[model samples]
Target: MLRLLKVLILLPITAILVVFAVSNRQSAVVSLWPLPYEIATPVFFLVLAPLILGVLLGGAAAWLAGGKSRRLARERARQIRTLEKAATTLPAVLS
Candidate 1:
């Protein structure tokens, strides 16, 4: 069931990508200044590279932004464990 759903979703996307790649096969020159480096690549690749990079950077940024919340949750769990241990030991010490 899940496999069928995945296939259904991916089939159209794959077809679209194939069409895009086929239509945009022209070569494009990419140059980086101050380094005297130039690369010639397909238009499809030129378009896709930046998109992939943006997605990766955006995901990394989001993960880093959530670090504080994750750390706080871990600290909260540790505090709860310490409190539970003290509560269990308190009655014995009192008696």
Candidate 2:
């Protein structure tokens, strides 16, 4: 069922991308400042590159932002384990 849903969603998107790439097959020149070399690529690639880059960067940023919360969760789990160990040892030591 999940696979069917994925196929339903992805099929149309893939078709659209193929159409877009075919329609925008013109060459585009990308120039970088302070560099002597420039890249000549397809218009579809020029349109898609920044979008892919943005998604990657945004994912990285979100992962980095979650680091603190993840760390806190680990620390909390460690504290709970330590407390459990201490509690388990207490009765033996007392007896």
Candidate 3:
């Protein structure tokens, strides 16, 4: 089921990407100032490279931001386990 869902989602996206790449086959020049370096590549590459890089960097930023919450959760889980152990060793209170 999961496989089918992924195929359904990915197939169209793959087709679109293929069409986009084919349509944007014209060469584009990329250069950086303060450096003597330049390369000619596909137009689609110029657009897609930054987009993919932004996605990776954004994901990393979000993961880093969540570290404090994850750490607190782990601390809470440890405290709960400790309390459970201590409770098991304690005498039961009468109702």
| Candidate 1 weakest ten by summed lDDT | 46-55
lDDT of 1 by residue, 34-74 (tens): 88999999999987789779989999999999999999999
Worst 10 residues of 2 by lDDT: 46-55
Rank order by TM-score, top first?
Answer: 3, 2, 1
Each candidate: RMSD to true structure?
A: 4.2, 3.6, 3.7
| Candidate 3 collision pairs | none
Error of 1 at 81 (Å): 2.3
Q: How high is the lDDT of residue 54 in model 3?
A: 100
Better of 1 and 3 by TM-score: 3
- Candidate 2, residues 1-95: lDDT per residue as tens digits? 99999999989988998899999999989888699889999999987888789989999999999999999999999999999999999999999
TM-scores, one per candidate: 0.62, 0.66, 0.70
Error of 2 at 10 (Å): 6.0
lDDT of each residue in 1-95, candidate 3, tens digit only: 99999999989988998898899999988887679998999999987789789989999999999999999999999999999987877766432
Give the number of the best model, judged by TM-score: 3
